[model samples]
Target: MQKVDAVPKTNKSYTVLISLIVALGGFLLGFDSAVISGAVKGITVYFEMTDSMLGFAVGCVIFGAMAGNLLAGPLADLFGRKKILIIVAAFFTISATWSAMATGYTEFIIARIIGGIGIGGAILIAPIYIAEIAPPKLRGSLVSFNQLNIVIGISVAYFSNYFLVNLEGESWRWMLGVEAIPAAIYFLSLWVVPKSPRWLILKLNNVTSAQKTLSKIGGAEYAEVTISEIQRGIAKKEEKGKISDLFKNKYATIMIIALGIAFFQQITGINAIFYYAPTIFEQAGGSTDSSFLQAIVVGLTNLVFTLVAIWLIDKLGRKPLLLIGTSFMTIALLMAAMAFNNATYNFNDDTLNKISDTEIKIALADLNGSSFDSQAALFSEIEPKLNQEQFLDFKRNQITNFIQINATLVLMAILLYVASFAISLGPVMWALISEIFPSRIKGIAISVVGFFNSLVSFSVTQVFPWELSNLGPTMTFAIYALLSFCAILFVYKFVIETKGRTLEEVEELLTRK
Candidate 1:
């Protein structure tokens, strides 16, 4: 298990400090992932790409994250957790510099993918490290530090992106390059924290070193009990972890729980909102500035609600939070769909008057008197009237002129959806994955489940741009709404409450069946 056993109240400060340092990795994960939201428009314009290509560019990092997830577990198990985190920090630094300096589309994709590797490694290892080091009494809160940092990072990214949006052609570069500062800090900070005591004891059989580390974590008595527990736990293990060992019938129940939670988290379209927040706002009749401002609000809402989740997670238990959050998510998504469902775009006299830009006004001369039932229809009507250059500019600014809907309702729905997600699946998935699996196969099990999680994230992010153009907002969000409803049922029926339980106890309870 990643977390230490029960410790005295006095020494718990050390545990919190180390957990905070490792959790910085999650901050980088959030910053790197969401910074792309602001850059989407600029990158598309700079790369001169089509909808499918834009989707590929946006989602490519998740593909790299998938690879990183596959490798992080075994590597962390083999090498030490601290060393792997240092390596991940280096990856983040290099990826930031390389991506900012990229001159071509291919180079940009490669750089983002590299950063994604760091994101994946950091995402899994930090939580595992926190779990390993934290005492059982504080395990839930400490492990959630990773998620807290993630949302904090996302909030910072949104604020950064919002402020940097005025930089015109170079804003995306600045937004991405800022990550190097935190990456360097995280890298240098790793030296101060000790390696995982569990790793030293179980993998290296260095009980002396483990004892010292555990003593630092808790106290002498606490260390003695924890070490004894570790020894007893290891004695029951049949062998070292194998890939096939994860699927043995004894482990199947826990495996299903891990895989299901991972799958459900991404399929609910959370990343689509995160990766494309500004774009979503723009599609709902917001200006570039308002979109960026609204993105900041979303970020703040996420940050605030994540704190709420951290406070309540151990108190309410995992299954209750899942049930509550998914229920809210379902309602919020339907609210989003309903908001978009009533939208209509038309080139009436009022809309025509709103087009102050001379070039855009001239471009829309032929369609001045036309009315469109939807944004898609308006876009289709305008598509044939302009050249590629004019088409790009037109697409960017069209919603400002003709959209007729309650834009505030859409924003509120999205914020509600984000708030619900932040308090539940956003942080809970990582916590649950770290908790549910048996220690023997924990590393590989997390890697496999994380791989599938990134895979789904990749698909959702990559297709979101296309989905916006083809399926439209109403249909796209309606699908997510339905899925959210199903997720509530899945959690209520299949998921077990795991708060306040030790990793060993949870493993035994779940797998005994």
Candidate 2:
């Protein structure tokens, strides 16, 4: 192994092309996560789901992702990253097709869970692959391509939902099944990209193949240097990392940072917003069409700001972005909380006419021209007037007609919150996780933290609808606001800057802390 005086110039176009193809998995993951938002109304009606049931249907994908997170790393290590990614693509294709055609509740859930498995694998594996292949100079930006594709997928899903919303019967089916075309394309695209060079060297001891792949990414000299580094890193490790190794005292800081970022990322309500964007807007008195449009705006904001993050991540460093992003996220959430807090539900004659259910319309006639200060107050006055089914229907569908809110303010707040997240937690967490771990424990540690991240995402998505119904939007947004504030403090106290540092340099720096 020879020591190199300078970092080799990489074959930039080649590295980027491979990264873009692999990151397509992130696009699929994003699409699968968000397409369901458009389908929510249809599925709730089609399945005749209660609040809890609706939550389960929406959150089940995360449940499947948990299984994927657990399985993806070990399988990638045993088989190879490229092969597992192909399997992930197949899972997405199957899940999309099956979920679209599913007529029964149980069947729909099964289909979604299968897709969730793909989501789990794609979300973890794509960045890991990108990180492994990328030069340190380009690592942050290239790895962020996964996050960029995610936001693009999300934006596309919103547009797809809006376009397909009027498709005769079972419009949700079209919205969901449309994903199959892209998923199949992704499956085929995986065939062209090379396996992770690190995986080739580490798992199969195929130095020649690894060098060939690396040579394509950089040059022969770059390949030689990188291979030497990988070999040296491997030589220093006595054994492969076990699950127990993550709990060691020396790794405590890494574990804390990983777990905290994982926890805050989801717990701050990003997924809940992504999964239920239209619903949140609708709660603020938006019409269905307007809500969908606003959701698209949210997606676009996310996409644009994610691009900004990519540009700044390697420039401004991770901690500053987290600090700045979390501060704005807190403020935006507070804006939303205040907007919802000041909202009033008023049932006038015009508002009553919007209720399609005649029985419920007549039942609510007595409350005509009356206004309530809050959703809880409004629900109290209306609950005893109707039976359980009617009440649920009114809450889900009709309440939007009567609410008087600052719709523009709510929209602005949501967009700001999303933009803040896009620049900060959304891409940075995965980037940090990929960079900070020791090579020995990296795979298992990521899986553990990813599983935790998915678990938090599931809980937030699962309980969101219930919170809107029970705690009301004001309290729900306020809770997120508080969490966002706490996130800022955590980053300030714990997270270290990792800008422009090699993975080995980052590990050494953090290990000393």
Candidate 3:
């Protein structure tokens, strides 16, 4: 029999250092997920493709992520977190190199999907890896380093995209190729980090090595009792349970909660803003040349606010941030509606077209009004209905204006959403996941959550563009904002707070009737 202590005595600084290596996976995840912004427009121009194809090219990574996240748990369970981190980092490095070299639309799409595998693996692994070693008091903050890295990665990608695209040649290729440096750094760090002790004891059945790793993760005084308690938890599970037990009522509630957390994170449509940011900015009445610059601003906002989230989560805890963030998001969504309404209604007026046709004419020279009138006459003479080209041009202008207003609104919403996510859906979800599972089922359950989360991410990423284009941006975002509202319902009624609770303490709470 082993005693389960209330907490582990780990040196916080050393433990966080190790977790940061795993968190590097997050940096790659953010970069790969977002770097598509720089390439979307240039890729379209280079390949001479359509919007639908462009969406597919960008969204295919989410599809690949579905499979990667599904595999993350089992692989991490079997191989240990350190080994898997190395593998994911390698996948990213290769994918980056290949993506940069891709010549055609199909090749680029394939490369993006491949990169998504790394993204999925990184997200699933980082939290699990960090949770395995983190002390309860520090766990939330430490795991959140993953989100912090994610924002940094997004900002870096944005900056890199801007700088690289300035080169005289194909700038998108350079935008993608830079990810390899970070991936390589992540891989090198894993060599020195110790494997998760809990993983060794429970999954590998190696007590001595587990104790050795635990002694370093926590101090020796801490590791002795902590390691004993961890094994006891595993032993208790071995005596009384099976994987199917997770489907029963006690565990089922937690599973539903975990799934909801995953779904709402994506349903907020944050990724949509990230994915189509430049395009959204372009629609907002900006030139193609300026869209990337706006994207950089969005990325910077994401980074700055993410740090705000990291600082706030441990202090204020998770739920409050979520409440504040979602409320902000809802208001932002309404404002977006207002912006799009302006764009949708203001399309194709003859007055606007007359203003654009004066190429070299003086600003004070109002004589060119007749030139648009003549062109309008010729267009009407040919078809008699509203001229298709002029109507499309008008719609484009309106869309640009609409996009501009909505995008500005979206940026504010995204900032709030990012802050909220950094605290709640971002870090707390993973903490709760680790907390809910009994030690015996931790590996499998983490994998299951990872699978479902990744799959939801894939579905949301793929469906949002079509929904936005067909249903209109206002409707699409409104639907996502609505989902966030529904998520509030789920959390209020069912969620259990896990902050500052020990592994045993959290598990016992789950068992309560």
Candidate 4:
């Protein structure tokens, strides 16, 4: 396996610039995926929905993502990566604007699904584009730029939602609409970046065009060497790529790693935390404003640690990071479970004394010292006792003051969970997915695993409200903790190290029985 040394200084800036342009797609992906965290309560209230309906509306984007991931590979293979990425940006813009103006739940779900399509496409294509074009010495860090932009986007969405959380009843609309600005920038930025040199060489069979694009990526010497390597790789896999090729014995190990990474990444409930951060905090006895503020903290922690992952990915290797991150994730999730498990809610003089707000005290005046097993139980028992407005007022303040669990402990646990995910699985998973397959089948292989990824994400996000309603926070997080435990073992025993290896070398090494 050859290492990518520093390219000629002249092409360094050019390589980084193009990589950043493509990475904007990741920004929109993060913003669209997470902006909903702050909007879910508003959407549920505005639409008068059941928990199931709320979950469906929240998870609808995954359906679109499923469709987009299913098609992105073939489409990028046929039409070129850059063109499809441009179209994905357009979809994001349309989804954002339409979602903001949506009049009903149905319309909002449709808009979210549209945005999901853009997210799915961008998630697959951006990393592929970066991996194909980046110098190997910097490939891990450069490709990680997509993940970095994603965390930045998530952080910005959290900030935006928090800033707009107090905008009366219209705050959710503002959160959804702000995505359009970045989407348009991503669409326009495509004009400046060159096409994937490998895509041009193999798919287009236009070496002259490929060489020109590669030249812009590095220098003429870098272009020649890269072209030779790509040509040799293509020659070895002369038989054309098909969906079936991925199932062959030689490709089995890579397939397992790809699909396993995709599954563990989502099934461990990362999206559950990201998509429902505010709701989780609110359920754990916090005000809506406080929930949104805590979500901002989660976003910032994600941003900072993702940068740490980028700094360490090439230096430390992929398998070690996955093992380390998942281990910490297990510990963090157990901490969250314990925090929720020990929490007790009792409406009493002691609880009353904790309340400093007048409206809350007045609303709960007759019910001091009454104990309920969960917030859901508490709400159900009290709903018929007061008017709707009074019920809501009491509930908000009750949540703010009732829980015996330490709020800071819950917040720290969640922050730890996000940090664990950011530095290991978050960026490393995508880097491995992009690097493991043969060039010819890379698109289709990633598509299959990516589709599976979206499906799991959809299922988890869709069922979360129900999980909270039925299992309670302690059990919901307990299940996630168990899954994280499994993921750590899976990484330790089966996942291989792909840190410094080239794509061709990884493919060759993994293909051996």
Residue-level lDDT of model 3, residues 216-280, one tens digit each, is 66667667877777866776674434457768787777778777787777777778777877766
- Which lDDT values do the candidates have, in the order given? 0.87, 0.93, 0.70, 0.87
> Candidate order by TM-score, highest to lowest?
2, 1, 4, 3
For candidate 1, write residues 1-513 as lDDT tens digits: 444445667887888899999999999999999999998878887888888788888888899899899999999999989999999999999999998888899999999899989988998899998888777778888989999999999999999999998985678889989999999999999999998988888899999999998899888877877888778778988987888998789988788788888888999999999999998898888889999999999999999999999999988878888889999999999999998888887776677777756777777877767777766777787777678767766665565567778998998899999999988899888888888887789889888989999999999998887788777888999999998998888888788887877777888898897
Tell me the tens digit of each residue's lDDT in model 2 across 345-389. Answer: 888889999999999999999998899999899989999999999
Q: For each candidate, how many residue pairs have backbone atoms clashing (under 3 Å)?
A: 4, 0, 4, 3
> How do the predictions measure up, each by TM-score?
0.95, 0.98, 0.86, 0.93
lDDT of 4 by residue, 188-248 (tens): 9997777788999888788998899778767788888888889899888766689999888
Residue ranges of candidate 2 with Cα displaced over 4 Å = 1-10
**Candidate 4 global CA lDDT score:** 0.87
Best by TM-score: 2
lDDT of 1: 0.87
Task: Give the better candidate number (2 or 4) by TM-score.
Answer: 2
Q: Give the range of the ten consecutive residues with the poorest summed lDDT in model 1.
A: 1-10
lDDT score of residue 513 within candidate 2:
78
